[model samples]
Target: MTFRSFIARTRVLLGATALVLAGLPTAASADVVFQSVANPTDVTKFTSPWCSSCSNQYRIFDQFTLGSASSVTGFSVALYSLAPYWGSGLNFSIWTANGNVPGTELFSQSLGNADFTTTTLTGTALMATTDKVSGLNLDAGTYYVSFYNTNLAVWGYTGGGGNLLQQGNTYHTGTSADFILTNNVPEPASIALVGLALVGLGVARRRKA
Candidate 1:
């Protein structure tokens, strides 16, 4: 081949290699969905984008009946920050609420906080405190979980108030983050329920005989 043609072919091969390498890192960072293995009532997980001004993620747990009369013995909540930027360098704070909004009561019991500076998308931070609702004694009803950008100074970089990061929106400023929620499984109760059903079936067959 001529000198020019050889140089052109070499450039095309180099460009293809560069594109493949560029895509590998993003493939590694894609978010993972956490699946529940036990009772759906016993465990729940939710995820949403971490916006500066808006509540990106919200969950209403009608299954959980909490009050002075009923108590959740094995209740647990785990929060995971999935922002690629936070894992890289950007800093932000996340907050949670058991109710909806200014009128709703926020979770002040301090489950815990996670910094994703070094962890990958698979990395997670946990707050495994037991009887999380005992102290708060939240009323029996639905609850809401929200995340906000606590650093006003940093959020200001997005041109100040109301420019919150949205889910699936490409970030033009700094990095955006996501959140994850996880609950513990009620192993004993689930196993017992299954066992009782089987026993009941056996007894009914013997009586019929």
Candidate 2:
């Protein structure tokens, strides 16, 4: 074969290799979005700011049943407190809903004054902490997670306060809090399906040749 033809063939081989490499598995491409389970009739993730009046987070679970035989394995929630108050803390809890009443307590955590800071707060610390309820074995059902300000007297903050008030006395109300629910578990057959598809494509290409 001519030298130019040999070079062309090498280039084609390199391009194919690159395409296969691109499809290789990597941690960065893993799925981390909320997804429904195969057996669950209903699923819901709830979150909000930590405050006494923020009862919407609590009432949503009143209408649904949560926690079935197949408990959520990779469910997670992130809590963020936007206000900057000294000695302020956030109290959060997870509950399974059973016909307008919160049933089992899944998990709970409290961030003391040290866990929150207005000076350098950006909602990173809360997100980085893994959910304490990673692999609970409960039934699948509608669930409600709730947040509250357990230390209302100490961590309470109201807007329109005068300048330079006491710690936890500023007008930094809990309006900037948010939560995200995501499914971390991969479908049992997803990997097998992808592998089979790739293999079939290769076999078909060979038969054509």
Top-TM-score candidate index: 2
lDDT string for model 1 (63-91, tens) is: 12223332222232222334432222222
Question: lDDT (0-100) at residue 168 of candidate 2?
Answer: 28
How much is 196 displaced in model 1, in angstroms? 31
User: What's model 2's overall lDDT?
Assistant: 0.37
Where model 2 places Cα greater than 4 Å from the true spot, the runs are: 1-22, 28-93, 108-133, 148-180, 186-209
Provide the RMSD of all predictions against the true structure, rounded to 1 decimal.
Answer: 23.1, 13.2
In the range 92-150, model 2's lDDT, one tens digit per residue, is 55576555446688766665555432322234213312233344444556654444453
TM-score of 1: 0.26
Once superposed on the true structure, which residue ranges of model 1 sit more than 4 Å away at CA?
Answer: 1-48, 52-69, 72-102, 111-134, 147-209
**What is the Cα root-mean-square deviation between model 2 and the actual structure?**
13.2
